[model samples]
Structures are given as C-alpha cells and as structure tokens.
Target: MNPAVKSLADRIEALLPQTQCTKCGFNGCRPYAEAMASGEAPCNRCPPGGAEGIVRLAAVLGAEPLPLDPERGSEQPRAVARIDESLCIGCTLCIQACPVDAIAGAAKQMHTVIPDWCTGCDLCVAPCPVDCIDMVPVTGERTGWAAWSQAQADAAHARFLARNARLVREREENDARLAAKAAAKLAAVQAEAPENDAERAAQERKRAIIQAAIERARQKQQAAQPRNTENVSAAVQAQIDAAEARRARAGLTRPGSDQNANTDPEEK
Candidate 1:
C-alpha cells in the first residue's frame, strides 16, 4: 500500500465511531475506511457514526457527504446490552460473539456485561440461545457521535484490535494442532501398511503362531478331562460268563452242583 493511501485510510478510520459493528457491509471499521480511501465504498455506510460520521469521512476523503443508507440501518440512540439474569441459560455464545470481550462468564454459568467495555454492537444478540438479552437504550434521543464520546470510541477501538489479534493467534494455534494430528494419523496409517513381502510374511507368521496356540490349548483341555476305559473287573467278567453258560444249558445244572442248589431242576 502507498503511504498516501494508508494515511488517508487512517484519517477515515479516525472519523468512524469505532464500533467495529460491520454495519458498513465490510468486516470492520478499518476495512470500510480502507475501502472508502481507495474509492471502492461510499463514505456514508456507518450507522453508528450517523450523519456526522459521513461528514467527517467526506472531509477526509474530499467527497460530498451522503445520507446513511436505509438499506443498512438508520442511526439510532446509543444502547447497551442487558441480560435478564433469571432467564440466562449461560450458553456462553454471547461471550464468544463479543468482539470486545465485554461479556464475562463461563459455560453453564450466568454472564454479565461490563458496561465500560461493551461497545453496544449487538453482535451478541443473535447468538443468544435464549431470548434473555435486551438492547436497552442508554442515550435516549442523543444519536450518533453525540451519544458516544471520543474516549469511549478510542477505548472500544483498542479492545477491538486486541480481540482481532487474539482471534488470529487462536486460529493459527488450532490450525497447527489440526495439521499435526493429521500428519500423525498419516504416519500411523503408513506404518500399518505392509512395505514389502517380508512385513506381510511376518504378519502371517504371527497369525500362524496364534492359531497354533489355540490348537494346543484345545488339545490340553481334552487331555485334562477324565475318560472311561470301559474295562470290567475280573469278578464281574466271571459272573457274566456263568450267566451266559446257564442260558446256553437251558436251565440245566452243572455236573458237580447239588440238586437243592439248582431250584429249577424240575423243569429239566
């Protein structure tokens, strides 16, 4: 950027209300100022600065003052955010959305506004999960710069710059962490890949070892259980032989046996 153009942009930025509200269709007051300095944007887009803001910008840029575009929004009284303590869900959305870090609280805890730090940008209003926030009018009919002082605007601008710096730093840190994690994941996937036949064979051998272990375990279990041989004692075998002989003789007694011992002799 040319030094002349940068100087002109700084002048335009100084004329701004420093709300950093982005009501000018740009990201912030500095962007709108730069756009105006470069002849890309009109000098009357800021609603927070109102008519006086346009005049200040036009003086700096050597252009005629224009009315604030109604499409953007009309100049209104300075307002501050008020949270209904009872209705607050403590979502912390407002805290994250606050460009000035004006809202203070943790998640699941009630948030309160720092009146001195609040820029009244209304950026936090939309992000509230619960309809607990109210934009209360602080300066009744005192609109534009009259409702806001130069000291207040300067302080707000300082806070806005700090907030933007903090956001950039955090984003860079988060991106670095994500990149590291992705690299680690890629390395892990590569490590798990089989580089050659040797690696694949090693894996196969490990599987075989596990399978052999399972088979051995099964055999050991079978060996540990009792098994009946089904062999009868000598006395029991003798009894069986005698029974079979008697059946074969058809109720006839043995040759040396007493007649009284064989009760079925009558049948023979």
Candidate 2:
C-alpha cells in the first residue's frame, strides 16, 4: 500500500466500529480501512460505522456525500456478543470470526466471549455451527459514553468482570431463595404429620376385636350344625390345623395361638 493510503487507512480504522462484523464486505475493520484508503471501496460500506463513519471518511478524503451501502446491514443500537452456553458446541468458529480476537478457547473446548473486546458487529453469529452466538444489548448501571470509549482495550476487560460478578450474585441470591422455600415447605408438612399415637393404637385394637368376634361366630355356627354338616367343618379344621403345624415348625408362632390372647371364654 502507498504511504498516503496507509495514513488514510489508519484514519478510516479509527472511525470504524471495529467489531469486524463484515457488514462492510470485508473480513475486519482493517481490511475495510485499506479498501477505503485505496478509493476502491466507498465510505458508506460499513453499517456498524453508520453515518458517522461516512462523514469521517468524507472529511479525511475530501470527498462528496454518498449514501450508505444498502447491501450492508442497517445501523442499530450497540450490542455485544453473547454465548448461549447450553447450545454452544465449542467449535471455536466464533473465535476465528472475531476481528479483535475477542473470543477465547481451544478447539472442541467450551468457549467464552471477551465482552470488552467485542464490537457487537454480529460477525461471529453466522459461523457458529451450533448457532450459540448472539448479539445482546448491554445493560447495567449506566456510565458515560466518553468514559466507556476512552478507556481503551482494557476498559472492555473491566466491564466484562463487572458483568460476570453481577450475574454470579444474582444466581446465588436465587439459589438461596429456592432453598429457603423448600425448607419451609418441608417444615410445614412435618408439622401436619400424624401426632396421636393413642388413636392409632385404638384403631388397631378395634380391628383385632372385630377379627376375634368373626372367628368366634364362625366356630359357634359350626358347633350348632348337624352331624352330616360336621364333615365340612372337620375338613376346614384339618386345613387350619395343618397351617398351624407348618407355622409352628417354622418357629413363626405357637400353633392355634394369638399374640393378643383372649383369656375369657366370652372373649374366645
């Protein structure tokens, strides 16, 4: 490149958004800068740079007014590159796409975005196989534009740390809130649990009493029957006796005995 064009290239680079978004039909800000300096490309080629870029370039080259290139993207408010961690495959496509080397990671490794260096050009969005890259608007406590711009490359780095810290604090607070809610729910359920042991014991005793009454009634009916009918009762008794014998051999219980024994004849 000629020295005059190189000087002009430097001036053009200063006016660019430096996002390397490729809306200007070039690989990065520098490439666009070189093209503009050579007069081969127009000043309106950069959408990220917008009208300001056109004005700056026209001033540098003493050229006439030109409309922005319609093929390039429209100028919208500034935003930054964001990685959708869940969808990101870590292919490093975005890393290669960045003009300022704003993305960091090895091949096949989870990639992180360098927010400070990101120009929000949307260049990295298309290259991602997983489509994990997005351009998200910057939010938080507001600061002056001049302060943000003048801070140089290092300022971008500091902003990144601040953003991360805010996110971590938010997550921690949310986790604590959820944990407290779960603990409170558990405590409430425990408080409502069955508390009266005497009631439960009474129900069990009533069940046993009913069972005994049924057995006694059956025995009484058998005893009242005629001798011919006694054969059926005898067979039933034999089955009961066999079952009892098996239980006794197994040491499960004494034959023909209940743990809550009926001592009185009426009870039996």
Candidate 3:
C-alpha cells in the first residue's frame, strides 16, 4: 500500500461502522476500505453504513454517491445477539464467531452476549449448532450511521485490534517456548561425549536433528512476530540492547543464533 492509498484507506476506515462483519465480502472494514481506496470495491456494499455511509465515502473519494447494494444486504434497525441460555448446550460457537468478543462463555458453559458491545453484525447467529442465538432489534427504525455512534465504532475497532494483537503474541510466545526447548535439547546432545567412532557419528546425527528442530522453531517465531520495528519504544530498545549484551558476555549463543556453529561437546 502506497502512502496515498493508505491515507485514503485510513480515512475510509474511520468512516466505517467497524462491525467487522463479512457482509461486505471482506474480512473487516479496514480491508474493505483498502479495496475501495484501490478502486477494487464500491462504497455501497456496507449495509450497516447504509445510504448515508455511501455518501460519506463518495465525499471522501470524490465519487458519486451510490445506494446501499441490495445484494449485499438490506439496512435494518440495529440489533444485538441474544443467546437462549437454556438451549445453549455450552457449544461456544457463537463466542468464536463474534468478531468483537461480545459473547462471553467457555466450552460446556452457557454463552451470553454483552448487548452494549454487540455490533449487531449477525455473524454469530448462523454458527450456533443449537440454534440458540437470536438477533434482537435494539434501535427501533434507526439504521446505518444514525443508529451507530463514532465512539461505539472506535471502541469496537480498538477491541478488534487488541484481540488480533493478543492472538499474535500468544502464538509467538508458544513458538519461542518451543524454540527454547529445542535449543536445550541441542545443548544436551552436544554435552554427550562419544566413547567410540560409532558413538561419535550417532551423536553428530542427533546434534544435526536437534539443530534442525531449533531452526524450524526459530523460523516459526520470526514469522509470527509483528514487523513493526520502527515503532519500538526507547525503553524497550534499551532493554533489548541490554539483553543482547548479556548474551554476548555469557559465551552462550542466543536461542536462534549460530544453530550450526561447531564447538567441542564438553566446552561448557
């Protein structure tokens, strides 16, 4: 995304309802905004935004206003998902489907929606295996931007972004743990002294296997990590520098560093 298109997409995303609903044929409002800014999608596909939203988008893009696309969906009064607790059967499908994390419950426990946080996206309705969720209209006849507030949209977007960040952090942490384990195993293999040529050959093979595992784990962790290096805070950078310095002084390679470096098995 070039600077100009990204700027346009940012403006477009700000105007979106931030429902994170897939009704627009995109995963979320930001992706839809990017598509629109790139001229790959029209501004009328968002039923939550309705006719008024199309006007706002047109004003931003200097394009003609379009009516909300009927094929995508019809604009209706805002609603919230309500789970029939008696019928819930503790499946938690609705919780998984909700983009805003509005549904609260665990597996084998009844799920309930926090009405205040619900975006009325209807995403959770279809995923319930027990057919216990219902969309209850909350905003009478008001629809689109009229029914939704800028504060609400901002809040929803914040929660969506936070959820994504947490998931990424969790995955990266898991990968790091696996990488640490593999590195430990590699160290253990290297510490095993060979008593004969055959034992030396077997130890070498084991070392090779452990090194490969560590490499794979490191690659996965690297891929899972966010690529926002430019946004690192000064304090965080200082901490990282200190940690690297410590590693250098300790005569121990970083977990992912020098996986294939040769050293005597008993050097430690």
Best by TM-score: 3
Give the winner by lDDT: 1 or 3: 3
lDDT per residue (tens digit) for residues 213-256 in model 3: 77766676666654222234465455445534543574422121
Per-residue lDDT tens digits of candidate 1, residues 1-268?
A: 6889877877787788878788889977878878988899998889999999888888888889998999889999989999988989877778777876677676676778877778889998998888898998899999999999887887676566555544444444543444454455445544565779998787666556545544543464345421111133464345435434543564321121112222222235
In candidate 1, list every pair of residues with a backbone clash: none
Ranking by TM-score: 3, 1, 2
For residues 35-69, write the lDDT of model 2, one tens digit per residue.
87898888888765566667777888789757787
Native-vs-model 1 lDDT?
0.70
Ranking by lDDT: 3, 1, 2
TM-score against native, each model: 0.67, 0.50, 0.76
Candidate 3 displacement at residue 123 in angstroms? 2.3
- As a whole number from 0 to 100, the lDDT of residue 10 in candidate 2 is 69
TM-score of 1: 0.67
